[model samples]
Target: MFSSDIKIHIHGTSFTIHTPSGKINISLPFLGYQNISNVLAATALSFSLKIPLKKIKNGLLATPILSGRLELIELKPHKILINDTYNSNVSSMISAIQVLDKMPGYKILVSGDMSELGKKSVLYHKIIGNTVNLYKIDEILTIGQISYEISKISNNGKHFLDHRQLNKYLKKIFFNKNKITILIKGSRNTRMEKVVEYLIKESKKHVNFVV
Candidate 1:
């Protein structure tokens, strides 16, 4: 049986996993509450498999960073990117916004349309916009047709009909800013990874590149 006294504590970019054996300190190379929840689920699964506590700790510590899935990229002079381009749903988007609210610095959210939501797409998108408005995010950039719904409810949001326009605008904005955290997310069909790639490439040439 798993330990009944398990406790989890999140402090900034790191979190502590307390188990019966010992405590494991983990620093995720990603952002968002979903990523932390994924780590917790993995820890529980390892315990159920009878993996040694030490090995579990080491494994979690050594977990490789994944691309376009809550991946964290840092640029010199204090610019951070949260790339969660793997996919999106109403639930995940809300969780991402909540994570952004807790983070320090100037928070910017770049969101693309969430596909596969079918008949509920409009309603869900508006819901996301309303939730984002309640967060501490400084700016919201939305792309695609359905995503415009998010901008409607946001206090400081701009909607772009195409990726080209969005990319151009972002380049100008990112180049002039420092000490900012940007969260990028969308569905697979939305090809949101392009936004992440654009920012990374631009950062190298314009900003003091870090990682």
Candidate 2:
């Protein structure tokens, strides 16, 4: 839809949006083409309303990072946490995985099942697994029944029965890794945000929650 109206040229962390009036250069703090698309959607509406390009640019820049949606937190120096526990689907998963793939460090993907997929549940899970492997994500930890399909296909993935098992496994591995980026994702039923909570509390309280 934006192909003709809004032309986006991406270079590194910033992108230039071409418009009828001029250009709007945007540097969103978060990652993903989806976010840029969203910005374009807003920009299109704004342009139609005759809003100034400067105001649109400022608004895009001023937009805050929403929690559990590409929100960045430092577990420690060089170790980053991506709290993408807001929701889960094939599209969102791929976007998050792509973001993680670009980051330089020991990458870990902590994921849970994408519910209500009906007949294509297994296929969806397999796609996620293949994408992770294709992107060369270091470790893929998955929970729940359907997500087990992800681990099955991922080269470095391991399926866990529950959060405790996953946590224990995480503690065992990553004992020596110094620089790491951990992205947690899941549907609401999976309650993957608890993993984020567990990491936060454990990072502050204990010594075993490495990486």
Candidate 3:
């Protein structure tokens, strides 16, 4: 069971997880509606396995952050990089965009074509475009063939044929001393991490990146 009232904050999310014995407040380090779904699934599994509430709480808090999965990387000065480049699909892409909508500062979305989408690739990309158009994203940069469709529909979107050109453009953006939050995501084959690497290298701040 779960409580109806759930509160979200910049620090974390607070929700009630009800079990056979009682209910406990669970807090997660990450944001987004998808993460809440994940927590619910985990809670159901833990209840089925008869795990103690205390252990469940501890495990939830101790969950190791994954690479390229909504990982927050703080750059020098005042900029944030959201690295969710592990992989992408229609569902995940929409979720990422929704998360960006809630974030403060100038929000920029850097996305690549989603792979393994089969025959519906164009359709899915179009859907993503429409979703982005509906959001408050300040800028959108897309890569790959299908992703071009996203840029076509966005108000301030640009499509890059390859990473090199995108990197060149990003170099200029990073030089600006504005507080910006960038969300980078794409399919696994897109190697979106390279873009993040370039940004860090350009910073020249000697900061260690998690990816």
For each candidate, give its TM-score against the true structure.
Answer: 0.86, 0.78, 0.77
lDDT of 1 by residue, 1-211 (tens): 3346666788887888887777888776656766677778888888778788779878887888877767778865567888989999988888788877876678899999999998999999999988898889999999998999998789999999899999988777666676788899999999999999988888777644333
The runs of at least 3 residues in candidate 3 whose Cα sits more than 4 Å from the true structure, single-residue gaps closed, are 3-29, 37-60, 205-211
Model 2's alpha-carbon lDDT is 0.84
lDDT of 3 at 141: 96
Local distance difference test values of all predictions, in order: 0.83, 0.84, 0.81
Instruction: Summing lDDT over every window of 10 consecutive residues in candidate 2, give the lowest-scoring window.
Output: 168-177
**Candidate 3's TM-score:** 0.77
Q: List the residue pairs that clash in candidate 3.
A: none
RMSD of each: 3.0, 3.4, 4.6
Candidate 1 segments exceeding 4 Å error? 44-53, 207-211
- Model 3, range 77-156, lDDT digits (tens) per residue? 55878899999999889989988887768889999989999998898898888889899999999999889999998899
